[model samples]
Target: MGIEAELITAADLPRLEQFDGLLIRDHTRIDNYTFAFAQRAAELGIALVDDPVSMQGCSSKLRQAKLFEAHGVPTPKTLVLTRETLPIVPALLGLPCVIKEPESSFSRGVHCVASEAELVELVTALLAHTPALIAQEFLPTGFDWRIGLVDRQAIFACRYHMVPGHWQVVRDAGTPEYCEGRTEAVALGDVPAAVLASARLAGDAIGDGFYGVDVKDLDERCVVIEVNDNPNVDAGHEDGVAGPELYEAVIGTIARRAFGAGR
Candidate 1:
């Protein structure tokens, strides 16, 4: 991480073949490096953290929506709109919807719109960031929950603050915040049933380690957003269950799944 990215990217490909386990982070950028490595790794019989097929599939909002529906997980009713085919927003999910980039990371291209005028303005801003976006029905009642999965298990979970008025990680928008978030020790029953099912589906879909599943629960049906490949384990840091114990579990899971050496 300290070295220059291009240097690593330009490094010898033949040397990389010496390793038995291939982690995507070996590539400086996941989209570029991970994708390229995945294509090559498949031939070498080495498994990638998040394979090319799942990463590519989850890269597009449309594909994610299909996965959600197939798994019976409820998500915001959304439309895949390009520059040419912008759908009517209200008829699909009503006002105060969100327009976001399908492949954006770190909330880079996500916007909350309240009205038709606001929607247009938000869309304009989003296009500047990402031309391809998903217009989703807004679920303002609750903050979007991020459930981190390790080896198809919900080991860590947290809820992100859409609005800081409620329990949230960070109050400032510009700065990254790690609030001592109140992450409930939930079983599958604590979360919306559909969310757990969807989380498992996402694990199956991505078939990787360190997955962060985004789900929307309206006290009833839980909607699946997308499965993230580089999911954060800061959840333990947020809740203060971190240090050694949590770290051990994380490493143990990775050893079992990634190396095929653990029980």
Candidate 2:
């Protein structure tokens, strides 16, 4: 907490060596400059939150599917849907399933299909862009547990309620009428053990870095939806329970990694 920090932009790439660590708060994409910054930071031996490994693993649903499977992380029945296998959606995942693009975020590039007609139509449209998609068994729930983890340890846990009359957390994001549901942060100890365990498994599957694992608790069983890097830690939302300690832990981890990891 005693460290001095300053915000840097893409144009400040030359100045990267001046800092001991970099915390990337911007939207990260493999093809974007944010990832390039991470690469450069790693090259310069500067510690980074959402390291390159975490970014690569968390950016794609296809990779996550395999990662979870390899590590035995509990997740909904999922399959990689390609154009060749479009007809098997109903037979495999059934109707009312959830479809997600590999690089989807903030509820964009995701769809809920009700019937075989919808499944074919949506997957057809989506495949035109990417060769594959993710189809999973629908787990209907009122809210999702977002557990924040740093270095594979639970830091803060919160319930992200679904938007009123919507199935996802956010509705019409990136639009003028965009809206999202409420967030209630709970103490880490108060979170369900299964939920925390699922999040931990997910974090372990990914690299040991900052992660926010989304888990659904249904029928008294918890299953991970996905592992995300650079998860939101809004002022009054995720910090409601952990408060400043959460921020300090995150910052401290980055500092330690900066001075400790391969430095």
Candidate 3:
């Protein structure tokens, strides 16, 4: 793989034809330029890590909830909350539940509400941005399992501990705060069978591509939280252990697809 990769911006869309493959690393939305780039790459027959299908599938938590249920993947009880159904969320999911925007990521648009009044306030505020929201039964897991998958295989594993005094992995109050837990690389074979199976099932439900499957393990029961595309793989964080091998696996897939070395 002697291919040279260069970083390009939205301005480089016209020049994408010169590249052999396109690995979209931006926040993708159906109406955004990233989706346009994926479409362009598809039209040009260039290899893409996260094609539009994966992007759209992973971007919506609402869709993920449906997928998890349809695929028999275990997940906490969730319901789509609208202005009409907002009043019954407490009865449906109970107090101390979690509310999330449909397209939220990095735990930015998520909130833990303990009462009906609080839920209404948060949902009303968030509804200004999105049409509907998700209310889920609160599962008090101190940490969540982040299983990185490439081509439907688990490549890396870590526990994303919740921020101290917060309920989500990433805290985005007045100032955003991330987990201080060290990423521990667990061998695929060493991972819990149920967790690995659920991760694979969740990733496959989206597509065969790069994904970070978030899961919560309570006792021996494992449930899928969400599947994210273009997941973080920073130098010291996600790539702290077995950095080269992980990078090679992702790049090799892209290169092989681009060069047509193996189909």
Candidate 4:
């Protein structure tokens, strides 16, 4: 895999013409430069790990809720949050529900509200800057199953354990007190069939590109958490069990898409 690659930043937009493909390794948001890069790559007919469509879809939890419902993908109870919907939240998702900003990344803008007071406080704070938010049923789980997929196939799997005494993966993310949980990559052969099936369905609902579908294994049943584009592939975490093959699978897909082998 002697693929010549170089690091780039937002300032290097003019130099994009020199590359056959692009792999975005940064947190993507609808209003960010990453999305612009994806759009530029698409305009240039370049192979990109996550096409602009995928980035846009994955950036909005509201859109994802509708997408999952339309595709019949299993997910926790989720609803769009607005000032009008505030009073009905408790009735819809109950207390201890989860609230998320549409463009949240790295678990920064996600919060678990255990009481009505907390729900209102958090939702009000979030909605002050954004037009809407997403409220989801609280599904308490010790860990979440992350299924990495490329071209609608599972390449690697890992269990992201929750931080102790916390309900989400990362506590105080984007702050000085930020801390995260443990990650244990698992062999694809050992992953539960239901988890894999749900992840594949979630990925299919999004697009046939790179994705990391997060799932919760509750009582042997699988519930999709979210579909993440431009998912992580850290050396000792996502690539732990799969080893070099993980890199090969991802790079090969990009190469094929770049050279018109499977575009």
What's the TM-score of each model vs. the native? 0.73, 0.96, 0.91, 0.95
Clash count, predicted structure 2: 0
For each candidate in the order shown, give its overall lDDT on alpha carbons.
0.61, 0.91, 0.83, 0.90
Identify the runs in model 3 with alpha carbons over 4 angstroms from their true place.
173-182, 261-263
Supply the global lDDT for candidate 1. Answer: 0.61
Residues 1-263 of candidate 1: C-alpha lDDT, one tens digit per residue: 11112233535466656655455543223457567776676777664555677566666666676666676555668787665545477677787777777765555446667788877766666667666678887776546677767667776555654544632233333565533334443433356666677677766765656677877777767767677776655544323433454456555653454457644
Tell me the tens digit of each residue's lDDT in model 3 across 23-110: 8888877778998998889899998888888888988888878888888888888898888889888888899999988887777778
On TM-score, who's better, 2 or 3? 2
Q: What is the lDDT of residue 186 in candidate 3?
A: 61
- Candidate 2 residue-wise lDDT, 6-70, digit = tens: 98899999888989899999988898899999999989889889789899999999999999999
Q: What shift in Å separates residue 100 of candidate 4 from its native position after superposition?
A: 1.1
Ranking by lDDT: 2, 4, 3, 1
Which residue runs of candidate 4 sit more than 4 Å off their true CA positions? none
Best-fitting candidate, scored by TM-score: 2
TM-score of 4: 0.95
Error of 1 at 132 (Å): 4.0
Tell me the lDDT of model 1 at 138: 70
TM-score of 2: 0.96
Checking candidate 3 for backbone clashes, the offending pairs are none
**Model with the higher lDDT, candidate 3 or 4:** 4
